[model samples]
Target: MRSFTGWTCLSNPSTNHLASLASAWLLWAMMATSLLAQPPLHVDGRRGPYHDHGRHGGPSGEFDLVEPTGAVTGRISLRRDQLIYRHGDGRQVVYRRNGRYDTPDGQFLGYYNTLLARVLKFPRSGFGHFLYADLDDFTPFPQASYRLLHPVGAGPIGGPIVGPWAGGYMTHDISVYGGGLGLPWLAPAPAFGWGMNAGPLGPMPFAPFPLNPLPLSPIPLNPGPVPIDTRRVALPDLPPAKIRFTNSSQRDVNVTLSDARQAGLSKTFRLGPAETHDMKLRRDAGHEWVETYELLSPDGQWITREVRHSIQPQPRYEIVVHEWRVQSVAIDRTARGNNRIEDINMQGKGIGRFLLPPGPELTDQTIDVFQSARAMQNQGTVTPLISDEQIQEQFRPSDRVSPFERALLQQQRAIQQAQQGQR
Candidate 1:
């Protein structure tokens, strides 16, 4: 082949050079156009926070599928023991849970429950079933989705919620339900109770009542036997007693006073080394004092000290420990430090499926509206049974999903497939 320089220098040099240059530019231009024409490639590594469907990513088979003919706008219900699905070609299909049925050879899709099932098929890999898929909005790969029918308020959803899209199964009403097959758990979720079928457009078959409305009985944390009426009333405030505490001990000390003599619940004062504390004592009733005083160190070791003075009534008193002193009564101790776990159980814990958030809130609202111990425990103990109004709310238009989400889901699924292929 003649070199470009040589060809250009040949006869009719200008014409040859112009023609060659034009052809080269045209070829380059064609290549650029082809590159631009190719569809854009995207790896949906994760769903944006904007498109979160509530079940922490990965396909949760929480949707219903219907072949798109024109559009599917209206109520779609999934009643137990009832079928409500059809294919694009008008062939009917049905969904079965916790079991399996025979479908066509190439359509053995995966299963989904409270847990996220593994991706069962590539968008159209032409093989096994695509567990969480919609035909009109076919997902080329199984992008992670979440469980659609969560037990009552157990999910981040409320009322009749619709899913992202609709499409049909590859075969006519057939499926398989594996129990221990790739499953790790089968926990029971809270339910408000099921209702009668309300015909089509019924995605919610149950009305949501508070889960176990009545709170479980609180465990008894008492250390010793209790008097039928051992409840203690708050002590009335009184004037303080005048006293002068002279710290003669070598180390610093802490002084506290309490009706229950609970160290942590009392007011504390730091008696510094070789410091004299002239103060007023928050009057101690002294009515329950057991004549003889036995002083125990922080670690329960015996301490020998004596300083006595009596006041009022007797007009004199004795505080033998020249340092801070806290009184403690003997407590019933158990093997595990307190009551037996069984005792706590017998007292009634876990009797229901719901609980109040930990830590008591002292907001005025809760305090102002007090429920008697008896009343609160038995309040809402029984569910009011699901109603028709609630069933309608389950799949309301606000919750109805459009096809756009499924499309986005497919993109992520495709990316997952690519990564899996590389692996």
Candidate 2:
């Protein structure tokens, strides 16, 4: 027994110390088990649960401006045809219904003719005050002088300014004077001349004050090539009188041939790998034979849907069943302007792959995951649908796992693999 400052303790010092140590060991063991139970992460470099990290605008009609690295830095709100952009850096800009736009600096209300704008390397013309014209001999109007507004926020004056336009630049010192509302006015003002600047609101050089040519256009980002969905394609139907089916695949298949029009007229047969079976329906004179066939796996799993074929029972018709497989593939667009196919290894950690179909349509076109699976089902192949939970599990990372926990997970996976191998 010992007396402390505020409370009295009655226990052996060595037992207390051992109790504390056991509590700590139990806590550490629990934590290690938790870490080892976590699933492995995907190496696909995709945005995980933090995809909407900086997302503030949650409603519709509001879009978060995301950077290339998936960070949300700003937001854009849509009001009919107008767009108001606000950045976290205290900058605000508004793109009006007209070609004009307003910013903290000044308003851009002047626009060159569509034809001349194209020659000056302006962006593609859209609907509104500007005419979406083509490159033809038709010239609607000559280039006119733009109205000069003195105050910064004041609207455009009026009429056009016409003069002998030589290549020059416009130098504006609008930040000198103040507008009525304390807004700074542009210095030297602006006079329309040859195109200056590079972007949408680039300054144009006043005529006869030419310095240098306009800067080159910015390069555009190239996303990987678009994948074509083959499930949407409509295939032609086959109509034959008599048919012979050959199991050209590696696995034995169970097939059922039946008369589609008459019930109780069916035959079930089993075909080994590379084996062939011929089936025919009893047809009367001048009558047509409508037959249907379906396939199943050796384990009694439905592989394909029943397909109807019109047969004549005249010439010998043969059909081959090819094996289907699920392959993991990814598109690597690292090379400039080229999309290359790269093989991926799931290794019991990653998720996703393509279900390859048999025959000519399987060229460079890789089918979509879900679509390919459904297509295989329609073609009588047993395919399992990937769940959303499986996808989320693949995105989970094991970085937080300690070395000891990692070793435990590896040992568990090895044991599982061994058990499977033995089975």
Candidate 3:
């Protein structure tokens, strides 16, 4: 029988075998080319199908895949007719019933109006005074204003037939303000007595009062003036702080500081338009740092605004080495199922075979390595001495195998010794 070793020689009797070997070599070359054609790995650890990088694009110029958090800024206004009301009892209320109108830009804005009325009450006595008081009662009143007897019990001998009359009065002047009611100075009470409850003058059957209408003396209508638009006025802006980072740890850093409330700083205070502020920052030993800015408006509104930066450390690399020995092997004879071949070559220094789907192949070989430096390099986990030219150029005579590789080699030697003893 011919020995398998040194079998490359092609003689006339073995030409067929030589042809078969050449065909196998060609198939392997094709498979290697296909594997090499796959695209590069991405930051997210995916192998790409190859995409276009625009003309102006570079690796460093790619948009950040992560979305950033941010803020929005704008303005808002209050409507008119929303009355600010103060009652006689000193209670304050806001009336909001008046409808809003559309702005030139089709936006709905607010509005206001003023209304007035007079409240009257008959005195307890038929002879008491019809006293009038302004908002400030202490102020002097114009003289010669006629005084009428309090309508209470002022008929039939002394009072109207309306039985002892409860307090009562009349008002003809009234108006509305900001969807609320208002009252100006009360008019002088007339001298003629409309007998209480005497039909119209008493009980119920009486015509409305015929008080002499003096030449419509126009009491100048005075509605309180609307407040000035203070929103447009510009407020003072804050100065920016000079910020600096002590550590060169990150590509960007962010720092934030709020003003002390005791410093008369209001929460609404913000950096003015077209203004920039600087802030200083110190490094925290052995920790990362981020800086941020919080802008505020003068009136304490939080004007949405922010600026961010980060600081990061330098890049680094490490070399690793490893070795291994064969433990045991078993020959597989069955060839009808998926169990064709997993591996063949043992004690190799590189990645080995990866199986494909099941097929009917009687003569196939697969190689697998349990601990190979080349496998690590192919996976991009560790730098290999032969292919990592940059690392090789930077190598020093004192640097040797890494600790992990040393341990692996030690284990491999022990396994080899044990195998020899078993033999």
**Candidate 3 lDDT over residue span 256-285, tens digit each:** 122322353322111212223333222221
Score residue 252 of candidate 3 by CA lDDT. Answer: 12
TM-scores, each model vs. reference: 0.14, 0.15, 0.14
> Model 2 segments beyond 4 Å from truth?
1-243, 284-377, 380-423
RMSD (Å) of each candidate, 1 decimal:
41.1, 38.2, 46.7
Q: With candidate 1 superimposed using the best TM-score fit, by how many Å does residue 131's alpha carbon deviate from the native?
A: 8.0
Arranged by lDDT with the best first, the candidates are 2, 1, 3
Kindly provide the TM-score of model 1 when superposed on the true structure, using C-alpha atoms: 0.14
Model 3 lDDT, full chain set? 0.24
Model 3 earns a TM-score of 0.14
Give the range where candidate 3 is weakest over 10 consecutive residues by summed lDDT.
Answer: 1-10
Residues 114-135 of candidate 1: C-alpha lDDT, one tens digit per residue? 2232222211111111234333
Angstrom error at residue 271, model 3: 26
Clashes of each: 35, 21, 64
Off by over 4 Å in 3: 1-214, 218-232, 248-423
Indicate whether candidate 2 or candidate 3 has the larger lDDT.
2
